[model samples]
Target: MHSRIGLFLSPVHETGQDPHLAVRRNLDLVEHADRLNFDEAWFGEHHTLGWGLVGAPETMIAAASQRTGQIKLAHGVVPLSGHHPFHVASRAVHLDHLSRGRYILGVGPGVPFDAKMFGLAPDVQRRRLDEALPTVLELVNGDSRITQKTDWYELQDAKLQLPRFNPHGIEVAMATSGTSSSSPRLVGKYGLSMTSFALPFALMTPGAPDHIGLAQQWKYAEESADEHGRTLRREDWRIALPVHVAETRAEAFADVREGYDRWLFEYFGKAAGREVISPDTPRERALEARVEAGGALVGSVEDVVQGIRRMQEATGGFGSLLVYVADWTSYEKTNRSLELLARYVSPQITGSAARPQEAVDWAVASRAAGR
Candidate 1:
């Protein structure tokens, strides 16, 4: 399993906060992450939720691409139901070309509130996604004429003016949960990668199980491949998590406590209409609950590493482990956490070559000289 770490661009609300400052801070993290040799930096989209400032991921990624080199930019998820197929295809293709093919287009039918924010009826989201996905796929694949008529949308002979630069185009991924039937089936049918949260609601629900969620998704992918008479490749599976790492278990928990709790409350509690609390639960129990129910990784470096290894063994080794590093935390701490993971944790898992001795020696010498 290739274990590359990616940072989710989490917007932070601070005391005396300016909205634009969050964007600047997030961009700063992207630049720092790129410099630290992180594989990818993902930007998420939301509307009416002060939780995130990047309502348009394409525009944000365009800015990020110019600011950094060698780090892939991903729209963690763009709500497919909110836009016309032509627009989504055109914009995604443009970002792909702009980033020189360093773009991963993640598409999903987002939360019901997001649909409501866009003046769209939540009931029609499935129909919209079903209608839009195929058309967008066809258009992005360089089709000049696409004619489709559906209950939610209709397109006739839609052709893209900008020539498709990426022959493979952007890799498509679906963000799904355990109980979502359409998303898993769509992922299989389209041969797209799958990324779903081990989220609270999905895990704690009576009918849904954590491992069962992953198993069902893989089952669909396998069936889809069998129907097409091809072996399913490893790169098609990704597991995303909220992770933090430090030298010791106590230090890791302490470092992440405030920010992690805030994130849980904001994202899971408030966003999902669940009861909010001060989170008196112990860190281990909280993490276990998330892991068993939703899939959060919060522990010491060794604990995190072991958990990832277990996940690989359990899931038959997925191709990617997308980590969330950004939240309501200091930029320096976030960078340090990423550096520790890259130096100590990822090397053992991914077999990436170690940093050269000369660079390490120079850093030590520079620090000694300064002292």
Candidate 2:
């Protein structure tokens, strides 16, 4: 099968933009992606950061599900560490039925800042995830009611009222941090899919863009699965990264200038406190570093294609490349990037389309020879 190309709408807004308008535009992006025949549209959940307007990812995803007919709608993540899994499963089932099985449930331990808002300690999130996830699985896919108790939550014969939309059950993906092995172990134990961390800076550490853990994550996942008498499939994995495509390298650079600046200056430099990109550093130099590291994609179609290839190599092999959504440029430019990815990046990046090259050559030769 061809690579699955998807959009992960974190829904970053321009400074001083209205939340209502930002949300509308983000939902509009889902429709645009659907029209382009993109494979999926995943929404993220974040409560902090003035710029991240997607407070409830499910709310937006539920709406997007109606607006989009073909593209799959996912949670990108529900931050299971802070939520009671029953509620998460219940809402997921609701969306599943509404979307008619087009829903994908993505769960994670969440970021430090957001978890802090919920009054959760950073180290305990993963432990809480470990306690809650198995019960969630039983509730979502199990035939009978489940009774489970933990320090953070207690489920007493809890069960979802709605029947699962897809008899096969909702497609589930566990989002992973580059440093954390909890996601892989949990996903492996349950035989579920995996979503690489959402952005370059946040993927590995607090705000570093090293992206040095894909191979290690999968290795740990397989080992965990083997320990559990299960197996992990490469096709069930997806890596999320920031991507913007344009006709030329310079144009692509220009398109992402504001977005990158905010990500580096406003988000990472000030709030995230990692100084991933120094204020004194040149914009082009920072962009080049991120691109060359396979952490972000901002360039021509070929450049984005190679970025994906670099990530694929890093992971050994995987299923999809989720374009972590951002509004670094105008709506027109952002939409154009998706169109370019669909029209050009989609076919060439996977090399699946390249398999038919010989046949095309024969047809061309036959036409030229008047045969």
Candidate 3:
């Protein structure tokens, strides 16, 4: 398993606090992550929600590029269905140039709420994504004139005027959940990296077999590689999650529980249209459920290290592990979490405090097997 730690710039609101403060705090956190020797720092893009402050990740990446050196800037996802392909490609290219090839473009079609906010119909979104992906790839690869005649969009000799920092291309990754969709296959087809969070619901449906959803994704990658007569390098796959670490498991759980209840269950749940209860569904309950279901990672330094190792083994050894350190919590607590993970958890997983690539072969071969 190739291991690296990352922080999620997910914002949480507290009473009497300015929501935009979250954005500023996240920038500070990124600087800290860089100093702490983290491999990447990610920012999420969302609209009409307090869950994330960044609505335009390209602009955020540009700002972040100037603030730090060495630490890679990632857009947890740029909603592909919400923006024009040419515009997205142009912005990313500019950031890559500005950062000197330190940008990781993570993109997805986005959630239902995102589509609704952008007034995109389902059919239009599907068609746009299919057409836009190829166009974006071409643009990133230095193709200036991309003409596409599609149902959702039409382009006539559209091209990017920016100079390419990477002629071969910088790293491109697809953001996904645990769904047996063609999206994962598309990632393999393009030989792009894959990054996903835990969506236990998808794997726990009434008729869903245990880990079936995960297996489906693995299968898709494998089959897509086979169909293309090539395998995706293992180093191109990643799994991201919200992680909290402390000196002891009890302390770690205690510190994060209140924040999880407030930010995750109360704040995010309400925003996501789920019921929130204080006592009946306490923060601990929510945390325990997700932990058992393989969603969030919370524990002492040793426990977190063990959890990471288990996940690495389960995925047949993945390449990258993105850890989210920001979410409705105090600056001190969040910083402490980042420090603990960086000091203790990261070294154990990466084995040398750098990126790991040993799992690349297995990832490629597994994707070729379609599972």
Best by TM-score: 2
Q: What TM-score, to 2 decimals, does candidate 2 have?
A: 0.92
Best by lDDT: 2
User: For model 1, how does the per-residue alpha-carbon lDDT over 270-350 read when each residue is reduced to its tens digit?
Assistant: 755665332444534554455444366666778888877877776677766777654735667667788877777887678
Give the deviation of candidate 2 from the true structure as CA RMSD: 2.7
Model 3 clash tally, residue pairs: 8
- What stretches of model 2 exceed 4 Å from their correct place? 1-3, 201-211, 278-284, 351-360, 367-371
Residues 49-99 of candidate 2 have per-residue lDDT tens digits of 777778788889888888888888999788889888899889989999888
List all candidate RMSDs to the true structure: 6.3, 2.7, 8.3
The full ranking of all candidates by TM-score, starting with the best, is: 2, 3, 1
Per-prediction TM-score to the true structure, in the order listed = 0.85, 0.92, 0.86
User: Model 3, residue 279: what's the lDDT?
Assistant: 46
Mark the regions of model 1 whose C-alpha exceeds 4 Å error after superposition.
Answer: 1-3, 10-16, 201-209, 228-231, 275-288, 291-294, 326-328, 353-371
**Overall lDDT per candidate, in order of appearance:** 0.72, 0.80, 0.71
Weakest ten-residue segment in model 1 by summed lDDT: 200-209
lDDT of candidate 3 over 1-371, digit per residue (tens): 22277765643344456767767877788888888888887777877665655677777778878989888888888777877788888888888898889898887777667788778877766667676887888877755587887655678898878777866686788876757566788787877788766543422232222234554676688788788876787666777777888788888788877777776655556766654333444444776766655666788888888877777666666766777554636678778988987777878776764434447767888899998
**On a 0 to 100 scale, what is the lDDT of residue 193 in model 1?**
77
